[model samples]
Structure formats: C-alpha cells, structure tokens
Target chain A: MNSVIFKKELKRNRKNTAIWTAIVVVFTALILSIFPSFSEMGEEMAKLMSSLPEEYAKALGMDEETWSSIIGYYGTYYGIYIILLIGIFTASTGATIIGKEERDGTAEFLLTRPISRGSIVWTKLMALGTLFIIIYGIQTLSAVIGLLIFGEDVNWPVFTTMHVHGFFLVGFFTASGVLMSSFLSSKLNYMGPVVGLIFGGYFLNAISMAVEKVSWLGYFSPYHYLNLTAKNGVLELNLITCLGASVVVAVFLWISNKRYLSRDIVG
Target chain B: MNAIELSSLSKFYGNQCGIESVSFAVKKGEIFGFIGPNGAGKSTTIRTLLGLLTATSGKAEILGMDTSNEGARIRERIGYLPSEVDYYSEMSSKELLLYHAAIYKVADAEKKIQELATYFQLELDRPIDDLSYGNKKKCAIIQSVLHDPEVLILDEPTGGLDPLMQNRFFELLERQNKKGVTIFFSSHVLSEIQRMCDRAAIIRDGKITAVEDISTLLSKQMKMVRLVTTSVNNIVLPVGALNHHQSGQKHTFDYVGPTQDLVIWLSSQSIIDVTLSEPDLERIFMNYYQS
Candidate 1:
C-alpha cells in the first residue's frame, strides 16, 4: 500500500547497485580498449583457432575463420561473460535484499509498522526490479559508448537486440534469486543454489556443444537465449521461450509472497 | 470494548514448545503488563495477538475482529515495538520514520516525523548504523507510535535505556495512555510495570499464572510480616497458611490470605510484640517463577 516505502528501499540499496554498475562499465571499457589492437594480432588468433577442434570452436561461439574478428570476439566471448556477470550480480543482490533483513533480525521492526506483510514483500520486489532495470540501462549505455570509442561500424538494431536479450536474462535471474531467498534464511544457504545454477547453466550449454546428440541441453539454460552468433549476428527474439520463462518468474513470485505471508518470521 | 482478547490460544514450532493454552483480555484504556522471564512465551503471545504467527489452536481477537482474518485491519490501528529493534543501517532516523509514516498512512507524515524526532531528541540526520543501542531503540519506539495507533504493543521498550531515558519512556507511555491509547507492554522490570500498568499477567513457562489488577496482584501476593514471643520454646506454625523463617526470638511469615485472620490467630499465641508488612512485587514475582 505504501509506494514510497518501495522507493526508499530502492534508495537504501542504491549504493551497492551503483558500485555494481560502475564495475560493469569499467570492465566493458577495459575489454573495448583491447579491441582495436586485435586487428594487428588477428593472424595469431586465426592460427590458434585453426588448432582447435570444431566442437571447441562451436562451444566458444566462434567459427574458425571469424574467431580473430573483434565483432566475433565481442559476440562470442565478452557477450556471454557479460550476460552471466549481470545475471549473477543481479540475482545475488535481489535475493539478499529481502532475505538479509530477516536474517539480521530486522524484519520484526519492518513488519510491526502499519504495513501488511504482502505489501512489504511486493515493495522489495519492486525495488529489486527497479535496480535490475537501472543496472541493465547502465550496462547498455556503457556498451554503446565502448562501441563508439572503438570506431566499430555498429548496427544499432542488432546492438539493441542483444541487450534486450540480456535484459530478459537478467530479469529471469533476479526473479530466481528472489525465489531462492524466500526459501533460504541465510546468505550461506543461498550460495550453493545460486552458484549451482549459474555454473550449471554454463556447463550444460558447453556440454551441449561437445555432444551433438544432447544439444537439447542448451535449451534448458537461460544462457541458450543469449546466442548472439545466430540470426545473422543479431539476437533472435524467442517470444515463446521468453514468455515461458516470464511465467515461471511470476509463479515463483506468487509462491514467495504466499509463503512469506503465511510463515512466522522466526528470526 | 476490550482492546485485545485471546481464548485458549496456543502455538508450537514443529516439535518444540511455544505458548500453550494462554488466554487473557486487555481493556480499552488500561496499561496491561505481561511479566515473564526469557522464553516464557511473552513474545510468542504478543506475536500471535498481532497475527504475525498463526495459532495452532483456539482464538485471538483484536478490536473485536479475528486476528487471522483481519490482521491487516488490526495492524492499521495498532503500534508495535519488538524486543530487538533493527533497521536498515544506511537509513537516517528521519528517513526511517518517513518510510514508516508512509506505510502507516499517517496524516501530515513529515510533521508527525518531526514531532516525534523532537520529542525523543533524536538526531534525524545521523545514519542508524552510527547510533548507539538506546538511540536505535528510541528510533524504533518513535516509529511505532508515530501513527497515533489505537493500541500500542511494546515488548521491553526500555530494555537498554539509562534511568533518565527509562523515566522519559514511562512519561511518554503515560502521555499516550492519557490520550486513550490501550497499552499492552511486556517487561521483566517489575518496577516499571508497578508504576505504569493498571492490570498485569505474570506468565511463566508459557502460562498466565496470574492476571489481576496491579494493586490486587501486589496486595494479594506480596507480603512482609514479623512475630515476637517471650518464650522461643516450641513454636510451630500452620503448614499451608504461611511460609516463614525464624531468627533467635522472632518469626516472619509471608502469605496470600487475609491479614485480620493472620492477626487474630497470632493474637491467640502468648502475648508478645507483633509486626506485619505489605507484599513487594519482587517477592511475588520470585514465588511465581519458582512455582
């Protein structure tokens, strides 16, 4: 009921959110700074690509010939890593924002106010959603700046599409974190599930590349939707899959709210 | 109307124990003190009344509405302060109060926050992380009562305060009570309750062992008595009517029966000096705990 409380919660976490955004921006700048020099070293990378097996090339999201190109490097290497980084950071922050209060014995104070428990949970979720969007915006802006500085001939639509996919991935991961936080009381308890999901998804995607027969495994990971190499070097918008994942997030949120409202805050 | 009521209320945590078969009612304009030692279910009962925990059996009603069914409505009119007050350390006292004010839909929230900050002499700009424990407790107390709730439920509200702050806290409660707020506070500090509560329930091991007017509870349970005799020969006292210890030629007894009956019975003994004293809450509390 109290919308201002939601804004204040977002403000409370603003410092950490800004720190993460700055880290992402700095990392992007550092990666882009090395791009223009890659042209001079293209021959060396081509030789390295040639020495690799076909499965390795595909797993790395590269073709043997294009492995040396800056665009291919960004799309295949930096793009996946950046997406994963965003997902991991967002999920960790989102999951802890609400759960940490409980763990620290602060939930009692918050709940004793005239606000309803459902409203508190909803406000926290909204605050996390706002932080996720802000982080995504900062990352997208930093990428655009990096592309401009590197003097790359960028396709605006393609660039925007890639980030859109990243946005969905980040959102899904944030929801996953919130869902996990509802079940986990301590930060330590959350680490195992979170690390398992991120690394498990990446490894599953990698395994799908090595064994063609089990290539379907990639579809199970949110990382699969982050394939910027396909669709003519642009992100392919998978409406059905995105919607399915969104539905999953919604269901998780509903369960989290219901569970939170019903359970006694023992901490 | 009764401010709050619980009938056969019970709560359990898995296989562990919580409150069991607890029941009491607080009147609309009384300061009701819940006295108990640690883990005696005082907090559990308060949480159940606030609808923060579901009762495994029986019923709890607040403002004539079922606690579970109308918890939000009940919360809207009730102010609560938990035993341990924790807040977002990054937020300033002003920010925290404003946030609570918004959630509570307090009228003229900014003004209300300022008024509370001024009343408590709180530093509005200082971050919560930097404040001392007593200051943090003040912030929590101010936030809880800022909305001018109809009922106030405070758990150990003055746990960490200095004597001056504790006295000021009592003054604040008295002021609120004057404004017709129904106060239900839990404390292990007997003197605080003695000075503030109109009625009280002494709880032990999750049960309300005694619930009566504060004066009646103190008068009936607390006592001081002395007896003297010329001969210290074979002086034996009644078994169930009194609890006593003797020194040289004097005897002292404490009990919960009528003083006249005790006086008359003592008069029947050999003529000597005699003395009687009223009960103190500390002794009554110790007896309740031991029982």
Candidate 2:
C-alpha cells in the first residue's frame, strides 16, 4: 500500500492522533466513572426519566430497561459522545489528509514524484484507516479499565457488539469524508460540507426519533444503525444493517479512489 | 531522439485559458530555456510535461515515454524544482530530505543530502517554517537534484537567491550538464536565461513565439557593440547601428546586419578597444510580446 506514503502520512498525522485519542479516552472514562452513582439511584432516576417528555428521553437514548445493565448503561450514556468524537476525528482527518498537500502548495512536489494517484490516495486512506482501529482499541481498553474501577458484572458480548457496530457506523462517515475531499478542486471546498454532513447525519437521528412522520430520516444517520437498545439490549445486530453499511463504505472508498485519480488537485 | 517533446499541448480552465496549443522539444543533454512573463503559460507548459496537470489536448513525451500514461516512469529519471516551493511546514530540512530519499530509494542518500545541505549553507535541523524564503528556495534546489536524475526541470529556481547563490547554482547546473543531464530551465528573468541557456523558447499568450539558438535569437534581432575610439567624430556609422551613445573615448550602440561592414569600418577608425556581444533577452522578449 505504498509504504513510503503510508509512513509519511503517519508522521503527518501523529499530533492529530495524540489529541483525538486523549479526548476520546479521557471523555469515555469520565462518563463511565459515574456508573456507581447511576446504579445506586436507579429507581429515582427511572421516575425522573419517565416524568420527562417521552420524545426527549427517547431522543437522548434514555431507556430504563437498557440502563439496568452495565453494558447498556455504558452504551446509552457514553456511546453518543464516543460516536461524535470519532465522527469528527475521522471525518476531519479524512477530509484534510489529501487536501493538506494542496493547501500547503506541496502537491507540485508530491504529484511529480514517481507514484500513481491511485497509490497516493489509497496510502492516505490506509493511514487514516488505522485511526479507526486505534480509536476503537483505545475505547475498548479504556471502557474495560473504567468498568473494573467503577462497577461489577460487565456484559462482555454486548459491549463488544456495541463497539464493533460503532466502528462500521462511524466508518461510513470516514469514507464519505475522504470521497468528498477527492472531489474538491480547492483545499477549502469540501471541509465545511463534510462537517455539515456529519452534524446533519447526527441531528437526523434525533429528529427522526422526535417526529414520527420523518422516521425514515434515521436511515441516513449512522447512529441509528443496529440500534443499541434493540431486542432488550442484548446487542443483536441485524445482518441486513451490517451488510448495508458495508456496501456504503465500500462504495464510498471505491469512488474516492476513482475520483482522486483524475481530479485536479488545486489550492 | 528528443529528450522531451510536446505537440499542441493545451490546458483550459473552464472558459479561461491556461495555455493554448503550445509545442516545443529539447534535445538530449541540452540546456533549454523557457522564457515568458507572468501568466504567459510557462508554468502550464511545464506542469503538463511533469504530468501535474493533464493537458486539454496534446501529446507529450519524455525520455521516449508518453507523459500522460507513463508519468511515474518518466518522473523516475526527472528532477523538478517548482516556481514557488513549499513543503510540510512542521518538518525540518533534514527530515524532509530523508523522506524524499526513502521515497526515491536514493543510494547513499545520507551522504548526498549532507553534501547538498552544506553546499547550499542550509541549516538542516531547523524546521521548514522557521527558514527564510531564500533558505527554503535553497532547500528546493537541493531536493530537485539530490537524486542525480537524468533530467532536471527547474522553474524560476533563482527567484529568492542573492547574486552569489545564483552564481553558485549556475555553476552546479553546469557541472550537472557536463555529466549529460538534460535541463529544461524556465524563467521570467531574461538576464539569467541569457547567461545560462544554450537554446531558448520564447512563449507568450500560451504559444511559442520563437524557438532558436541563443546566438541566432540575439544576433538576428540585435547586438550590443561597445568600442573605445580615439575620436568618436572620426567613426563612420554602420548601415544599421541604432541608439548611439558616446562618453569620452567610448561609443556604444545596438547594431544589426553583417559583421563584415562593421569590421571594415572598425579597421578604418583609430581604435583603442572594442567588445561585441548579444544583448540580453529582454528586447527580443518585448518584440515577441508586442508582435
């Protein structure tokens, strides 16, 4: 996968990795640390949640039966924050990795090198591709460590399902972000659109949950895939949803490579 | 066979023109100059050759390989220094050079990079963002030739360098040419082109107005003649010498036509010393632009 470019991308992205990893890991730990208090006051919390508007509770992913279990507790409380952080971390990084060369006027230096655009795009994708695995690794490790320090009786299968499903869910944005970058004629062209699309996908999930007429809007949001509270929070992922997300990721990545091959890189 | 060739290469950005049907060729082991003013398509032609921007319509070949399809292989033997240089801002000069070395798989790259660094007087350990414009230009020059490629494509390589550094760079280029490297030197600076190029192609408005040997290009258009005579009043003016100026015993002017007539006239005069040479490319460039 063009090891030279892969290593160069690694060096270019080291600081980004450090900043985002710290934000996600520390943020996840902080959320998990409150689990003991959540467990002690579970009944009062349920009453208070029920008294709140049903739409607000559902939009915020507050489910009483799901909250009774540790994994569901973690998923409902911490998953959204993790998703947003990763969505931003992946999308912004994906959008800018190739665009940076154009922005800094370094494309002339690089494009003249003895490498095809296919190799260039894929190597950059491969570099950002590792961040998905890394952030996932850090999340899994930090969540496990947090669970040990704050609670008991962890739901191992469900926790693994939530994170695994989360990866595919967030990967769609990452691929789309890269594809958007490939189509931009200028460095500043696609970044705002990418961030807007991410937030649009996020709020669509909330709006779809809040309004019955627009429930189908949830289909466009990665957060709604394999709904974490489904089937009594046992973490059973629908095979159809998994297959569909895979198709989307593959399509976006393929299109990104193809578009990058011919698109003029301008800044 | 030509080392580099372009036939009707055109690039249009939307309705605006970048270049239009530009064509030229450089012989093997030749130092070819490309001269034009800003926005006159010098960069567009070179960028097309390097495969950085695909041409709208044309055929381009380098080292017997098509630039459109075989860019990677063509670039393997080519070194390019762009008009304006920029790189990863956070990387030090040493780090950037090493990165290129690894990418190009350069042999004994450490020694080569160190040698160029010293030659350019570049502080290798300082971050690129901390370097001055001239220092960055030095880094660009060093990287372009560090691989010792068979061809060098330099665009305005001396923009930010002082006179001394520019002189050293010219010397470096001469050394490389002696080793049989084909060079395509592009500049808007006429004096540098006059000083360095063996052959030059004058491009304007996206077209090559003239491609001629430096000698023929200058001699056909104008020659600058300087002569020291005991009496300026005693000199007989040649048939087509223009803009005569005299200061004490010296007379200078732009001359055109046969050297035989000028020599006969010079032998008749009480001459002290005389020097005849091609004028700079500026007047020729102006003629091309105006016409």
Candidate 3:
C-alpha cells in the first residue's frame, strides 16, 4: 500500500471520523452512566418489564435480567443504538471513501499519479480500517469506564461477547457499504442507502424475533447470527459466524478492488 | 526511439466513438502539437495515452514502456496538465503541491514547490476553492512540472492565463525543451501550435487529417489575396485560387499555387490597390478541413 495515499485518505476523513466518534462515545457514556438508576429500581423495573407486551419486549431484547445487571442493560441499548450508530458512520464513510474522488473530478489527478490502482484501493481500505478501529476503540473504552463508574459485580464475559458480536456486525455493515458503492454510480448520495442497509438488517432480525410465524426472516440479517444481546445474563461469540463473516468481508473487498481497477476515470 | 508512440489507438464508449484509429509519434526532445477543434477527440486521445481510459484496440508506448502495462512507472517519469483544473477543494495550494510531490517522491520538493510558486506568482496559502479559475490553472501548471519529469503532456494549458503568464509559460517550456524534455502540446489554437510546435497533427471527427512540419504547413503557398481594381470589369481568376469573393471593386480569394502565377495575374488586372499576406493558422486549418 502507498503510504502517501493512505495518509492523505486518513487526513481527509479525520474530521468526519472525529464528529462520528464524538457522537458514539457520548452515546455510550450516556447509556452506561444511566445504568445505576435503573439497577437501583431493579425490582420495580422487572415488574415494569413483565407488564410490557411479550412480543414488544422480545423484539427489543429486554428481560428481567436487563434491569439486574449493567451488561444486560447496556447490551439491549448497545445493539439497538450504539452498534447501529457506529455502523452508520462506518458504512457511510466506507461508501464514499473511494467514490468521492471520482465524484469530485479529482480522479483524473489521482489515477494519473505514480501508483497502481491496486495500491490505491489497498491504501484507501487501510485508511478505512484505521478509522473503524479509532471509533470502535474509543467507544469501547468509554463503555468500560462508564461501567466501572456506575456498576457493581459486572458480567465481564457477557460484555466481551456482546462487543465481539458488535465488532462483526459493524464490520459486515462496513464491507456491505464498500460493495454497494462499487456497484452504484459515483455521483449517487450514498448515505440514504447505507443507512437503509444497516437499519434494515437490524429490523429484519427484530421483526423475526418478535413474530414466530416469520422466524425465517432472521436468517437474512447478520444480526441474527451475530447475537448482540445476552440471554439470562450470558452471551457467547459464535466462532463459525465470525469466520464466515470474515470470508464475506474479504470477498466484498476483493470485488470492490476489482471494480475500481477497471472503472474509467471520466470527468 | 520515439518519446511517445500510438499505434492505431482507439477508444469507444460502448458503440459511440470517442477516438478511432488514431496514430502518431513524438520524437525525442521535440515539441509536437496536436491540433483539433472542440469535441474533436483531442482530449480522448490524451486520456487514452495517460491510461485514464482503456483503449478499445491497439496500444501506446511511452519512453519504451507500454502504457497499459507500465502506467505507474511511466507516470513517474511524466507530468500531465489537464484541460480543466479540479483539485481537492479543502487543501491549500501548498498542501496540494506537497501532496503531489510526496506521491512522486520528488527530492527537495519543498524548495522546488516554493520556486515554482514564485515563478507563477501564486499564493500558496489560499485554499483551492477560494482561488479564481486562472489561479487554479496556475496551481495545475505548477504541479505538472514540479516533479521535473522527462515528458510533459499538456492539454489546453493556457486557457486561463494572462498574456504575461502565457509568455512565461512558453519561456519555461522552451527552457525545458532545451534540456531534452519531450513535450506533447495539445491545443485548438493553431497560432500557438505554429509558434511553438516543430510538427503538428490535425485531428477531425476522431481521425488525423494531416501530420506536417511547421515549415511545410507555412510553405503550402496559401495566401489571402485582396485586390481593389480600378473598375468593375471581368477579372481572370487564377487556377489555384479558392473561395473567391467580390464586393464592389474589391476581390479576395485564397491562392494555393505558385506565387509567380498569382503575381502575373495581378499585373494583368487594372488594380488600384492589392495586398497579399500569409493566412492565419485558422484559415490553414480550414483548408485542411475543406480538403
């Protein structure tokens, strides 16, 4: 990979990355910091959970344990908001990272540079990975600090499993964004489609979980296989799902690189 | 060996033609011009040569390397100035130039960037989006040459420059040429071609009509003839004259043959005033178009 291009790409996305990272970390802290109040009223909150409609409760991944433990409480919101928020940022950024050059008429300047297209794509991907890690790392760190400050006898294994699943979920969404951008026109506004893809996947799983009649719909969403919430205060990472998703991400990146290499740099 | 060579290079957009069967060669250390009107496939050929667009057929070679296979290596040794200037809007000129230099791995890039910016009288601190079109063009020019490339491919390079900058640009080009840099200059302005190019190829409708030396194009015996006769009388037309026009006592036409024949014919007329001059490159270009 060309370091010059990689560095430039990273610098180009820095502001956007910062804005999204701030939002994610703040959201993480807000959710985690509020857990203390919820745990204090655990008995009353369990009664409230029972009073809620069973279908709606299942759809949202809320249960009796949700109010009893910080990890359980955070897991419900983490899947619903935190992972989705991070996914949206990464997916949208991934969509535009390469196509933005073509849309801005700067592809002529870049493609004519003394670097192979393979190197260009690889470097940009590296930049994308770096951005992903920065946002993801900071948000996770914020979660840990928030838990330390607000919780007692935290379920560390459940928390780790939920985060591992969150990693795969966000990664799959990011790769999907790269693949989608490769197939679409460079001039397209990709935010709409990127948001739709990530949210749509979540809702598919949610809807199938809430309705037993259409449980097969969950198969189509990556969230179904990569469980983002714990059951009975326990969550375990699925090795096969992680390995399969890695293969899919690799395929997606390969296809994106191939598409980029053959595209004409038209102004 | 030729500095640049195209062998029947063609580019087609689906079934539509961008350029077709175009072939030319630029000798080492020569200023070769590519002349064509707007939408005449000039940019298409240049883009194909730079490997921005894949050729439908045939091949291109630069400095003994095939462009399709060795584009990155070939680009390392070449500098290209596009007809339109489009750069990263958020970057200042200094940042953009530094980035470009970094891509090429140029040595002493900071000093070179400053020198070129001074020569162009450009403010390096201004963001690209805030700069005027001419200023952007200047920045483009600076980036194209900052690497001190062995070959320079320029397309409509002087569109936004003032007369003074244009002169400086030409002077710089001449200096580079003297240093054995091969320059491929593309423009629709025939005078620029006539003034700077040793040879030129005229393209029309995606095909090269003629490739001639500058001296040969000037020596074609084509002259714009205007005669103010003493009276309205029958004037014997020269055989080589074309597009003759008469308004009152004045008669004008393009004379394409021997100068002696035209002089003899002029002596026979009852002329009050007569003038003959070499036509501008526009008329010469039109002659090729018409032929």
Best by DockQ: 3
lDDT-best of 1 and 2: 2
**Best-to-worst ranking by lDDT:** 3, 2, 1
Write down the worst ten-residue block by lDDT for model 2 chain A: A226-235
The TM-score obtained by model 3 is 0.94
Q: What is the C-alpha lDDT of each candidate?
A: 0.78, 0.82, 0.90
| Candidate 3 displacement at residue A20 in angstroms | 0.5
In candidate 2, position B157 carries an lDDT of 93
Q: Which candidate is the best by TM-score?
A: 3
lDDT of 3 by residue, A1-267 (tens): 999898899899999999999998998888888888888898899899999999899999888878888888888899999999999999999999999998999999999998988888889989999999999999999999899998888899988888888898899999999999999999999999999998899999999999999999999999999997888776877989999999999999999999998888867
Tell me the interface RMSD of model 3, in angstroms: 0.7
Q: Tens-digit lDDT track for model 1 on A1-267?
A: 467777777777888888888888888888777877865677887787778897887776776424344455566655457777777778887678778877777777777665778888888888888888888888888877888878456656656666666677777788888888888765455756776777788778877977799999998887776555544555566677678778888998898888788878764
TM-score of each: 0.87, 0.90, 0.94
Give Cα distance to truth, residue A233, candidate 3, Å. Answer: 1.5
Model 2 agreement with the true structure over B1-291: per-residue lDDT tens digits: 899998988998898788888888999999999988777888888888887787889899999999989999998899999888888898999988988888899999989989988888889999999999999999999889988899999998998999889989999999999999999999987778778889998888888888989887555556578999876474667876777798878999877756777778778778889998766556555543343
Q: What is the interface RMSD of candidate 1, in Å?
A: 1.6
Model 1, range B18-82, lDDT digits (tens) per residue?
Answer: 98889999999889999877788899998888866888898988889898778878888998888
